[model samples]
Target: MINIQSGIPGFDQLTVSELTEGGIPEKSTTLIYGPPKTGKSIFCNQFTYNGLSNQEPCLYVSTDQGYKQVQRDMTDFQWLIQNYIQNQTIYFIDGISHLSGGKFENKNNIVSSSVSNPADLMVKVGIGTRNVYKTSNHFRSILDSLNTLFAFNPDQMVIKILKAYLRRITEAGGTGLIAYTEGITDPKTENELKSLFNNTIRLDGQHIHIKSDHPDFDEVQYFESTYTITDNGIVVNENNFKNIN
Candidate 1:
């Protein structure tokens, strides 16, 4: 049986099975990169929310959408994360607020940063995640999209920052996911990110593709599946998903 499952229906049963045999390996990081409107945010939400529901401490680092907007998105999708926030099972790091003229937050589980590189954002995440580790031995984290940071910092600088923080997660024995916005960061850099993360997946319309050269994954595995954004929460054709190479 898969030990750690992606909350998405077809996902855990297929690609993760194809890639890792088991579910996403613990103490690892996966990159979910793609253009907008392709359910990237929902994918991350589903992962973190699943961990939270399992009584595992979860940390959400929002670089693109602020925590409130993520909350709204989860609400629209009917995942309902507010209770997790209320009980502190889930901690949040908001990186978009200060850039948008909002004040910084340092108190409570919901912390805010000044919208900077992973160095600054990492500090906020480190603080919140450290707290989560106080009582829990395992956790899952997500940096919604690093594309926001890439827009300002040099790709090399951004890459170094991500490498350092991801190493931190590995040392702490937690799984992480960092999303990438399609077509914004250069293709060369994107390829570098694919190499760095080792496990990378692409979200395109109703099609999800996995691209990697690792021995564990072959070339571009694509899956045809559908999803909903309403109170239907999330729906996936788990049993009928078609895998096309």
Candidate 2:
């Protein structure tokens, strides 16, 4: 039997039953998809921070901005640089440059190989390394903002990239949450990606709907949670949740 942990407080109360009934493991792949400004990034940050607070190592892969900018934004959530971020157990990989064919090491050189798949790029960039591990213990988590990839076509190259990325994380016995914005409007592509995930979480408005692909589960559950951006970070009011089981 696999035990899945809901990173969100109060939110877990509504999900625990379904997760247990489905037997989804702890170190599994979760997809959080929604429109822009729906608190996707904040949710990822909170999930990552939860792991860090538990003395678990986490890797945050950002395709939209550099590490410095993310760090700055996180500071508003009461996340101190020296205490919670800098040289800590949480590691950040600034993947924004990699999208524009920029070299990971030398910012000057233009990368000849364009990597559409983030999972492959993660390994190429040495994300799973001792240096990355030096920061925390949980040593397992991923947040890939999928907006960058939608710029290209939904071809096998894209699928291969996602597959490679998820495989790397799962193989290492780590769990991950990949974020996808509502850009690639093609239903076929969306369905294909959905097939790859073990669980799918949609943040629509102020509600979070969760679904699992496990055979033991056949129903989708909805929960109400408040989304707020504050100085201390994204605070989710899980206690006010009501399950749509």
Candidate 3:
């Protein structure tokens, strides 16, 4: 049985046993939640790149940044860019524009101009829409940012998109990591989405918490890892967490 491990080197020393014990549950979905600048995206990138290095194709659907920007950011991590990112084992889909519903410049003109033909308007709307469809059928993992979707519509509509996305990934026999910002504070909404995931990881400053749905596993565990932004990537120093039981 292949063990699911965090891509970070020393960090795996903290989570290897648990992940190897039950094989990290096949088709598992995890949510990494944290406030802004709390290393959520970095963590997502690590997982995606790790899967790629393992010869597992990974998809990174970005709702916040463009393809070029993401590439530029990853350049800081030499290993990431040279080993996996540049090798095309990892794919990127920019969905940031979709989160805005439609382009503001295009919508303004349509609204300002007295175009009475609803059909024409519908066509124009469709033309302005941005849809990102995956080309590859086999992907071992997908990392998507939920913050953009929530910014688009805070209603139940976002939930529908999330469910569809998750279903697509799992149906393809791949694991996925969906990230949500800590801004959404409604417990009911959080729980509703949480039920869809097999695992949930929370990041707060330097603290990391993992929660699993399986009863036999440690449902809740904490790690005192220093979340540092380095040139190579986001490094997690788990040596300080002696009480990680």
Q: Which number leads on lDDT?
A: 1
lDDT of 3 at 183: 63
lDDT of 1 by residue, 1-245 (tens): 22466777666666543545535657667899777878788888888878887887787888887888999888776778888888888888888887888766565898877456457777776777687777476888888888788877788988888887788766776788888888877789878887887567777765566543343445544544555443444456565566665
RMSD in order of candidates: 3.0, 4.6, 7.8
Model 1, which residues run further than 4 Å from truth? 16-22, 211-234, 239-245
* lDDT by residue (tens digit), candidate 2, 58-106: 7667766666566676666755544545445665566666566544652
Question: Which clashing pairs does model 1 show?
Answer: none
Model 2 score (lDDT) = 0.61
Worst lDDT window (10 residues) for model 3?
106-115
Report model 1's TM-score to 2 decimal places: 0.85
| Alpha-carbon shift of residue 61 in model 1 (angstroms) | 0.7
- Give lDDT tens digits, candidate 3, residues 1-245: 33465575555554444434422445677888878887787777776666666676665666676544666676557544444544555545555543334442322111211112223322332222211114244445544577656665654766766676667666665677778888674778878888888777778877766655644455444344555666666666766543355
Q: Compute each candidate's TM-score over C-alphas.
A: 0.85, 0.77, 0.72
